[model samples]
Target chain A: MKRIILSGYIFLFISFVISAQGFKVKAGGNQTFYFEDKGGRNQATFFSTTPLEDINGTANGIGGSVTFDVANFAKSLKGTITIQVASMNSGIELRNRHLQSPNWLDAAKYPEISFQIKSVTELKQIADNRLGFKILGDFTLHGVTKEVTADADVTYLDESEQTQKRAPGDLLGVRAKFSINLSEYGVDNAVIGNKVSEKIEVGVNLVGSNKK
Target chain B: MNRNQKKILTAVVIIIAISFIVWIIFGGEIFTKTQVLVEKKDELFPDMITKEWRNKFIWGLDLTGMVSFLSVIIGGFFYFRLRDKKHK
Candidate 1:
């Protein structure tokens, strides 16, 4: 009886350690577009908010992976995402139609946007609860891929508090921010003219449930 | 009132209501400020790009546009059905 109890405790401890270290990718994020000239003014702007929907040309879900290396100072992430060109919403039906045409996203030819992270730098911890880091990656859009860097904030929620609220353990909240250029990806079209700004911003918040 | 006349009036009313709603939702003066911002950006930096601001603006507009689109579609369908009944 004594040996059995000891083994059970060891097993429980191993399980807890495994559960504490993991990664998950969140899909309900937004990618926005902005156009401005040299003067720091904003020009035409729009966003693809529902990028995970089938109507938006994606595969009905967002695809990405999260990895946690508790022993190491840094974690890693990489995955491909599909954004339906037709899902681009700009308030006006006419404008949306224009965006889906050959001039913009060209949903038919380039139906998805994919990203692959090449490196990650773990920065100093912020506020004890939040971890700061920078991710260097390559994003592909409209058939053109470019290297970019994004800021990330990762937070770990106390297990006892999370359990009291009945929240999933894996979903310790995560937030990431980054920016991109449309012109660099060759998404320029006639309706937007040359007046469209090349820069765009992207943000992601992921709540992942542990698979184990 | 005759069924046909009743249907026609209903259709007209619905159409007007929908147009009003669209005007209220999409025709607001917010775009004016957006236009101004774009113009300023173009004139000042010309080469610099502010992706963060643009993305946030685009994301909000996208959400609003989607909601409005759904509302319009539902409203338009009712109007069309009422109009078809009147024509018959």
Candidate 2:
């Protein structure tokens, strides 16, 4: 039993070390922005319709593969990004709370928004330590999934200049922008057709590290 | 199978009937008005209302579901009350 336990510990440690070569991601708070036009959305609950302010929300609860090096993060990586809906904040206290309510996105039932990369295309080296590409994936929101393509620009930082001292390897900075149609994801509404833009613009930035 | 079982089942049906009648008179109107309000509101704040809104109105499936829920609670309440009276 003692020998078996020792062997188990060794196996776990070895696997951890091996997997360290792959990048782990820490999405910074306010780094992921989900923007919506707020002008027309207020008339649903209020009678007087002075256009409300634009709705800008941030969710820090983002995760999934940050793995990759210049040769790997995009080319060799099959990454998934998951965002917890309950963690989203729209700046307005009541609106922020309501965004997760059953009346809106029903975060209690559909608690997550996720994207899974199916393919990466148009990879080109823009300059030294910089690459530009497009990523196609299935973006699932409010229990609906739709294929989307995001334009991505990756900038490679020096291997030794690591901000997250807890992790090993080089840092790859990624900025990806994409557009999603709310109606396409079963999130249609009267205002969405008119006041709010049918398409929601999303932006994400993260520093990925290739741990070795 | 026994007297208690039969009595409880009948009480449950009665409670369900009462709930449906009440829904028709009061909850029914509230549900309808809410539906209209939601639609009107959607005209301005279309993105504010959710997809769940449509099916929860008076003539919708969720209204029927609410009736079922009300039936169970009314049934349980009457059963327990009758049992307590008998004991007393």
Candidate 3:
């Protein structure tokens, strides 16, 4: 009876240790995650509020890869997140066409909007496996490149049966938000401030896997 | 009303009716949207994906332009009617 109770205690202790393991224990030092999902579940969204109208738009052509050093997250993190201009959709077909036309984003000329991550700062550990930080990056839009900072939250999930259902390897979930001024990006639309606000808020939510 | 006057009136009424119908069909939005953003929950993750645009009926170029186009057409007709009456 004493041996049985001791075995039970050993099992409980092992379970507690396993469950308490953090991102550092699961992800180790350096891990690179590719921000490509098979279901095209990655998303980038923009919102513009003006006196005349409020506009909401989304683009799903998100593709990129981030190499995150779990040990040196603030300095060694780097990646680029991209959105295809043609994938931008506003609710109206005519409006979408107009947006992609030369007067607006001109998808034909500049095909992509990208943010290249330079560094992470102000890192805050939100949970055992989650982090919040400010990311400084170069935001390129409408053929113009500008340095921008975005607030981001990242969560690391170790490979498990639950996570395997979504992808093959360990997963990193990133949610970042920032705002941009259209004029600064050379997007000189006449409807700015009327139909569309000059500054638009952008959000990105993506899940990346460390698998190939 | 005279025949020309009657014709212009009928044209105006038709244009108004068409405009009202289009407005009702398009959710009666005061200003048309250029694009729509769609968000859906991921099945496994605590995140959202921008799904394909739905609510197709709520989209189009600014209906204000359509109303203006119809007004210009009616204006041309009214101008011709006035010219004809003057000649007579």
Candidate No. with top lDDT = 3
TM-score of candidate 1 against the unseen true structure: 0.48
Candidate 3 docks at the CAPRI level of acceptable
Classified by CAPRI criteria, candidate 2 counts as incorrect
Off by over 4 Å in 2: A1-51, A66-69, A72-75, A161-168, A189-195, B1-88
Q: How much DockQ does model 3 earn?
A: 0.46
The alpha-carbon deviation from the true structure for residue A30 of candidate 2, after best TM-score superposition, in angstroms, is 29
Worst 10 residues of 1 chain A by lDDT: A52-61
Candidate 3 Cα misplacement greater than 4 A, ranges: A1-25, A190-195, B2-26, B31-36, B47-52, B59-88
Residues B1-88, candidate 1: write the lDDT tens digits: 5565466556656665664565456544323112111212212212223232222222233444555566567655665564544445
Per-residue lDDT of model 3, residues B1-88, tens digit only: 4677667767776776777777777776766654334557765556445455655445333575677587768766785666545435
What residue runs in model 1 are displaced by over 4 Å at the alpha carbon? A1-61, A73-86, A127-129, A158-167, B1-88
Highest-scoring model, DockQ: 3
Residue-wise C-alpha lDDT for candidate 3, range A1-212, written one tens digit per residue? 99999999999987755443235546687899998666767878888886756777788788989986775677779889899889887676777899998889999999999999998777776787787889999999999999999999888888999889888999888899999998899998875434677789999989999996
TM-score of the second chain for every model? 0.36, 0.37, 0.57
Local accuracy of candidate 2 as per-residue lDDT tens digits, B16-63: 677667666554532222322222212211222221122233442346
Residue range A178-205, candidate 1, lDDT tens digits = 7787778988767646554555666554
By lDDT, the better pick of 1 and 3 is: 3
Query: What TM-score would each prediction reach against the true structure?
Result: 0.48, 0.49, 0.74
